[model samples]
Target: MSTSFTHIFNGDSTAEAYAHSGLEGQEFVWREMVVQGPSKGIPGQESFFGPRRTYFQKELGMSAESYYSLTEEEWHRMAGASRRGEWVLWYEYDVFCQFNLIALLAGIHYWDNPPDRLSLICVGEDENHRWNTLANFSPDQYPKLLDTRKGLTHDDLLYAATVWEAFIQKAPLGLLPFAQTPHPSFPYLGLAIGYYLRQFPQAHNGLNTLEDILLQEIAQSPKTQPQLIRQVLLQRNHPFGFGDLQWMWYMKKLQPLWLQEDDHLSLTNLGKKVLEGDTVYREHLAGRHFGGATALDYIWEEDREEIRPFPEK
Candidate 1:
């Protein structure tokens, strides 16, 4: 009832890390993998969450009730109990958190009592430019991060809301302009757009950026699950914000292109061809939704710097 600010953390990990920071305010720990499923529609609403529900159930084995309780309930509860104070969003610079960030920004516009003041604490690298996470930092370091929080103005949120709507509508070309010059309130916004665009299937091989990277790593040698994950995470060219659970799902979808022997995985001949651009991986793949569009709805060519529509066969 008497707090100066409300803190919105990216997930449980970030929240847990700052629980003892001695800051007094309402704490909202965001819970959702916005990067893994259909991201269209008004966030926090079940209507737009149908595809996400199935995605989680099939890929992560999470039940509908579990998903609802984990996401919508917490999201709504936070807004319902919102106090009149500066709302601070603690996120990461990676695409995963950025995806959630924009969606949350857009969703806030529909809240019965939206935040009067919006601020953000986003961390990705330290002074030496070393990659780090909130959880990776010691508890004492939280205050320093809090001190660097950037306040977002009304125009900033408006832009973010617009971007989310455009993304959900599957008009990606409209978003390309922002990938280079993002709004000042969110410097990472443009970077997030670039990162996400890279994930679209390549025009040549039909393999997405991350998938191609995975295949290349696998081709180096038969790799145990842990080794592969570790290598991917450490690679400088690794997909920004791509996580273990997402990789697991990708492996499941790409089983046909890989040979799994016991705990190790190696690329099959099909995988080699797909990786090399000799095969169109998407042709053999099942339909997959990304936000409002299916996987094959567009092809992103890195060299061409374009995301053009791909005619479905």
Candidate 2:
């Protein structure tokens, strides 16, 4: 799908309001809306977008109109969408979804404004998951924060974390710690790491892996389902099927707190926690040879090169 979608400017009122407010200049491609009120339509041929508005609103906290007024036609011309802008936004929305930090923070701070204050939320590259999460949240604490003075609670954080990861998995690393790629192994590795960290909540020194974690001297004792997954992965060094097996076992039998899909895989609330826990750091600590000659590496090797030579001794 195109990174650009139906210009969600909605009605003229919302369009004009948001256009004047601060959204128009933020690299948002605007087009004529069909079906009038809140119609979901793609951007039209006459659409326009630029970055001047984005920088003004984001960095200066200026209103959209105030920011736009500063720009002459020349400035606006410079701000127009380019391939670079599209790529950057796409990475933020499509691949890593870190760009929604703006909206999420705004939603979190919605109460700072008057009770009836409405802000225009933009669509980043990862509109699918981002929009879905927003729709789910709109009915909950966010609107309530606007209606009342109450702040978000732990449950809200949990929900937000899930929503955060669902999009963040596609976002950039600077926006979030973990960057999910289209690679199949990437998410699988993520799921494994998430499972491990949830169980061994305590911080430990030195390099660690699913195998190291499972066979640890401390792991023999009983653990939560989250911990079990980690321990199993860290302790066992088996065939490629083992990874899938463990994933299936936990996702199928465990019934974790995170959301599940029909594919028999699940994403847990603790994913963000794991993301924050420095999986990359841990990977770095584990050294290049930590995983050893595992089945997982074998498949990756086969895919990268037809010959599956064993690792250098």
Candidate 3:
């Protein structure tokens, strides 16, 4: 029935790799960044894509037509794939891919009928605890990777829907239980969601985990944007699988805290103060959005690993 097998890849690069690997499945690249922008309500609706289109246009300069053609169309195909044939989703263990995976699972959970099978090939670290890249693997290794794919259960689908619902709502803490308890089928999900929760500003330095690392790294080794992005990829590897585009957005947002001298970046006095806990970088939250909620609405308490509503200034 349908095309026997449909492989949904996390991105174009991954999809391209699978193509060269001689896989016999129809390839579909999931090109959306659901990790960013608004996703509070039902994900597939036009309302969900409105703020998403605006955000992408403002931040990445992607046009509304391009958003529909490039991103929205892919999602519709992914929906139809459930009834088409057995599908194998190829994604990684990073926060970027995890959010995408959760959203995809949520979409599938609500689909009309289950196909012959649904599976996942989520790559993570190796025995030495180093990051593994499936795309970097040799063509011969592709078959072995496919063998590692885990079939999904109805409960797993429900879990992803529940996690996604909490994610798009003002319910970051609700994700903790799922983060604490790892699902057998979704090994890397717990760790990824844990990273997501820590995105709120930490109490110690008023910087989120990623923001603190980014600033701290920049302070240690001042570099140009390109150099800084390259360094961040190496430093924040594995579960942090952020690329240049994500880094560009973050670097732009931290402009007030960093000084750009001849295209190189370093912390400003205010940035230093914020880093040392002398000042709170509340200004960083001025126009920041974390999913459906404004980032300013919550402060992260590291010791408790929870976000508390930030008192209004």
Candidate 4:
């Protein structure tokens, strides 16, 4: 008789790696949802997925049917697993996975009776510091991780619930207080919230942190788009698990400030000025960003050092 364990993975890549890890009699569930989209965090209360589906299709130009095909099914599987098996959550210590982790915990809180045994295996760094993601680890490394899994506590679930509520609220300012305080259950939550704050336009340059990184990197040395992206990812200490597609979207938005000569991309005079803090980019180049229940046209006010909504036209 083989032992059975329920493994809930953060994404497809990690789940695929674990599927081939020779773990026996294990039920694998991939949490395919991304909380980066517009949401109300009211998963079961009302249907929030419809607006999210529309946002991906209309704003991001993603195929709605393709992206959200199995999400409902996977979520159902995860909830069901909690009732019957020793379940483990496999996530990383970045904003992307952390957001998902909190959302999952919030969902589990609604359960009449949660899992009998719940364990978590969250990997941030390995011995060499080269592997930041579980998908990057070898099969042999997984067994050791499985052995060291920590049990999830009630305090952890409560913390997640609080954070998830803040994340989905219309006003992101609610997160400021939470980010300032440290929670023992979630050591990385504060840092992750810091990163999330940087996602708003920077007051000085009017560029988000990711955009700033991209412009600075290209300005340092002109490189192809793929090369620049890889460099950015390599140097990133707190990656938000952005894929190539999302990177491409940001690059497309910044195209006006870049001069693509041959296959290489370089910054324009305006881009350079924007980077040097001589001029703001948001006034001319401001774009839309969705936060939970709010659709915002915002600019980072340098003097105030806060994100302010664009005045209504």
Candidate 5:
């Protein structure tokens, strides 16, 4: 009656760190997967991932050859282990990890007869309920957290399926209603969905929510790049779980409308006009796209609080 356990970590760093801890028994098998790309949750494997692969290579300067090699290996390993062992998922509670978790769950659900003993250990806070991440925990600290893992419930699976389907839609407006609902199992999901919706251009200002926040913060006080990034992350109820690289990507996108003087980041005349609601920022926006929609495809109309798709070309 010995249980074969397979631990699936969200990233290699966490998986490698835990392996060094010597806490995981020899009986346990560890697998790591990094699925933090824009192509996640898409229905078709090749058709959807093909463009993203090229974008990661040509646009993002990532090595597509090596990236997909590792991804395919890990995906197969996890898929195989899920059929044979007690599956334990180790994930963080951020937009990145939550999306990966949903995608993984959807994959598992698609299997004809997946393992029933699925458990999850998602960490997002410390004992005091302070914001924290898996990187905050040491190897010795992980074993204790494993005890907190809970069995996956039917409701959790249903929610994951629904979210996965909505996320892959060509039009992200499919996610708006779900964002309004409370997800107890995945608490951060609602906020993540809201954050995703805000990626669309703002109807009046033509700036996404994050872009608007950046402009507003810069208008209040000119700060260095690092200072502005810190301020945005420290906001009381910030929804974005973007890392420094992602933040820099947005900064790069808005550079055309910003002015750097005395090492401080400030808005240009056009930026100020957009901030004041006197002019729309869409035309100035760099060619940024998300999922299957470009920045020009849809707009988040604040007055109606709905995503309006642009007229088809």
Candidate 6:
């Protein structure tokens, strides 16, 4: 009885993809977080409609012919699907300020330095315990900056930095997964593996058995190798040949990432390192590890809505 957690970004075909992936007995949940607000100044007073297409026309300098050529419905579906997944819908104001506060804290930890914008630098920390100093500050508290709450301390920031890295590392690759242009997949994969390592500090030295680690990842996700391969191929929009592109990347490479020739695909010491947060890319493959130590390597915001990690904070 093993359980795996995932967060699906609400705005994409994530649900459909996973639903169609052919993995058995996968339980799913869904939630919504608004990210944008409606437009203003309309006869219906509807915030949903944009002010006008005039701005887009002016900005792009589209001619009458070009303007008419735009596929409004196609564009609308794409935009609407994406918007459906947000966990928070915010306007120019501060109603949904807590998560924004969290994002600011996360950003500071990400950049490893104070931000240039004051509004963004609301969270801080130190060596001891991290504190959302900005959590409860009222406007009257600080008239100087005109903002409330302070930043995180040094220890707090360091801890947060570590956690922030892990958080982004675990998030789904999103457009990066389908990006056929610059090929950001390798780097993104590296970051994800690195974060997985960070998540499980206990498995740092348990690399002697790669097979066990790879098995562990599969056990958690409850997907077989063929199923995994099929999912990847389907996502890529490639032909599902017997062994077309499969031999090139999916079968040998990604599979070997966790498994070895001795048996099936397994985890390696290097794989453990990637899962533990040391960070390694596909091209820079030196050592690999697999076994029960292989953690979930990929995730998305939409999948996460249903299967969530234990809340650490």
Give the winner by lDDT: 3
User: How accurate locally is residue 212 in candidate 1, as Cα lDDT from 0 to 100?
Assistant: 80
Can you tell me which runs of candidate 1 are displaced by over 4 Å? 1-3, 125-127
Q: Give the per-residue lDDT of model 6 (tens digit) for 163-220.
A: 3333333332222222223211111222222222322212223221222233345434
Query: For every model shown, what is its TM-score relative to the native structure?
Result: 0.92, 0.18, 0.92, 0.85, 0.80, 0.20
Residues 1-313 of candidate 2: C-alpha lDDT, one tens digit per residue = 5232112221223334333332223333221111001111111111111333443354335567764443333233323423221211111111112212222322233222221211333222142533222222322333332232223343433433443333222111221233233222122223322332222112322122332333232224545545556555455533122333334332332232234344232334443234334332233221121111222121112122121222322
Model 5 / residue 86 / CA error / Å: 1.9
In model 2, state the lDDT of residue 76.
34
Better of 3 and 5 by lDDT: 3
Q: Write the per-residue lDDT of candidate 4 for residues 1-313, one digit (tens) a residue.
A: 6446888888777777787788754565554334456766545333655665676787578687654665655566556654565778888878777777777787777678887778888887567865477866887678888886888887777777777788777677777777789876566667677666666676677787778888988899989999988887766654577676667777887776788899999999999999999987764343354455332355555456565564533
lDDT of 1 by residue, 228-258 (tens): 8888886645327767778777777788888
In candidate 3, position 57 carries an lDDT of 89
**Regions more than 4 Å wrong, model 2:** 1-139, 142-208, 217-220, 224-310
Between candidates 3 and 6, the TM-score winner? 3
Deviation in angstroms for 125 in model 6? 30
Q: lDDT of each prediction vs. the true structure?
A: 0.78, 0.28, 0.79, 0.70, 0.70, 0.29
Judged by lDDT against the true structure, how good is candidate 5? 0.70
Q: Order of all candidates by lDDT, from best down to worst?
A: 3, 1, 4, 5, 6, 2
Candidate 4: count the clashes: 0
Candidate 3, TM-score vs. the true structure?
A: 0.92
lDDT of 5 by residue, 1-313 (tens): 9676677777777787779666542222222111223454442245544665666666556687754665544565555554565778888777667766887776667667767678888887667978777778888888887888888876677678787877766677777777788776776777667667777878777888888888888999989999999888767356456666667767777886799999998889999898888987776444556654566788887777668887434
Q: After superposition on all CA atoms, how large is the RMSD of candidate 2?
A: 20.3
Residue 105 miss distance in model 3 (angstroms): 0.8
| Candidate 3 local lDDT, 75-159, one digit each (tens) | 7776665456678899888888989888878877876686668899988888898778666677767878988888898888898
